[model samples]
Target: LSTVHIESDNANNTLIAIGGDNVYLTFTPEEPLLLDSIVVTIAGLATTLTESNGSYTATLTLTGSEPDGILEFTIDFKDRAGNPGIQVTATTDESYVNHDIYPPEIEIISITSNNSDSTWAKVGDSVFVTFTASETLDNISITIAGVSSSYNELSVAKYQGYHVMDDSNDEGDIPFLITYTDLGGAIGPDADTTTNNTNVQFDKTVPEFSLTRMATNNVYGDSLAGIGSVDTLSFTISENQRDLNVELAGSQKTPEQEELNFITTHTFSESD
Candidate 1:
């Protein structure tokens, strides 16, 4: 007996067989064989060969519950004179079948922006994203703020990518989506826009503030000239701010107190 080829319905002309696919084994006999005298077995499953175009073929369907490993085939047949012969062969080229049964599981590690000081993303800023997977993947892509971009593989299980912010993107909390394909050609989950777990705030408007004089003294029209004279100034900001600082006469000073709507006051005194 001579083995012609071994393949599967998913990939033709290859020994590797994907899970849940039918594996076909074809062989040709050295001498003409009698009908109903050929028996074939693969992976311990017995099958009968049918003559087709001068060659005999046997098919075995995998239910995806088979262990992931190499497969072997056994052929037993009898010639026209009833001479029995047996042939055994293994999958060639160190190939395996049914190795990949489960799809890759992916998780988002982090989604950040170039602005390290804040989580707010602005126009022209680069938004970075990183993730991990249970298995190696390919054709990775990430979508952020309606922009889709490809990712780079940093390692077998880690990937990173970035997208530049633009004016077309919407403001407020922004969510991202990730799509990938595992080594088994399994497509990952669709773009998830409803999850807020990896959200980043996007803001384009700049904060504004105003300074006003709250007190006047006779020593100077709008400023303090000498010792014992004091002038109070009020600082009003459009939004709440943290670590606010004020520069007065080449010196830095912190607000005495902060009030509602981001209003702060400071009293300055001049000395000779």
Candidate 2:
């Protein structure tokens, strides 16, 4: 019978790599006839002949001097009956050269408060971090404090969002580790273990306070006052206070100067 058809495992040209990469070629004939010998020409160079199991298997270790892009090759073989099969020649689809042997570049752009652009925030204030990379990433993640965040593929290298700064965050250089895999899945030395330090000033201290007396239409800020038609007590805080409340002590003086007191509470409005 005449040799009908021939095929290769490396067909469709999807299996690609750099010059130093490995290539495994297995030729399949139309029938299970034993192959006399198989010769493969890659980059215009012929390989040594070898055959097994009615098919041809040749493992080629490409040299660094091989061409970078498309790998052009041809296969010529004959049956054990000494009948020449067919002359097969084909080229691989365009493939990228593995020139990027180094790791991807990672950088911390800024760490800002979620409510504002301030790097310093109160303990309960929400915060976020922004970062970037030099190349497209297959996966990227951040670990802050003792918490690890989920990673996602980045359409662009730069990434930012809620990266785990919350009310539970403590004050200090929040030690964070950034791990990533490049689009080509190349991880350099310490690339997956790279870390960054962000110093976040978390204010947990309460504001200092002072008492002032504001009489009816009184302009002078004073702490003590005498009898007046109307009296108002004012409290001053060192910082912009939120949800402030004041407790007042009501007192009545007897003829013997003995005082009877009662406790009253006052809350401030938002405008105050």
lDDT of 2 at 152: 41
Candidate 2 segments exceeding 4 Å error: 1-22, 30-37, 41-53, 61-102, 107-109, 123-126, 151-154, 189-200, 204-272
Number of the top-ranking candidate, with lDDT as the measure:
1
Q: In candidate 2, where is summed lDDT lowest over 10 consecutive residues?
A: 253-262
Predicted candidate 1 versus true structure: per-residue lDDT over 1-272, tens digit per residue: 65456767654324445566787777777788877777788777886467876788888887666656566677777889998876547533334344456666676467778876547788888877778778777567788777887677888888877788888989887667788776556566754542235556888876777664455354656554344544455667776556677765455656565652332333445532
lDDT of each: 0.67, 0.50
The true-versus-predicted C-alpha distance at residue 20 of model 2, in Å, is: 8.9
Candidate 2: residue 267 lDDT (0-100):
30
lDDT of 2 at 87: 75
User: Model 2 TM-score?
Assistant: 0.51
Off by over 4 Å in 1: 1-4, 11-20, 28-35, 46-56, 68-73, 79-81, 138-141, 190-199, 211-220, 242-245, 257-272
TM-score for each model: 0.75, 0.51
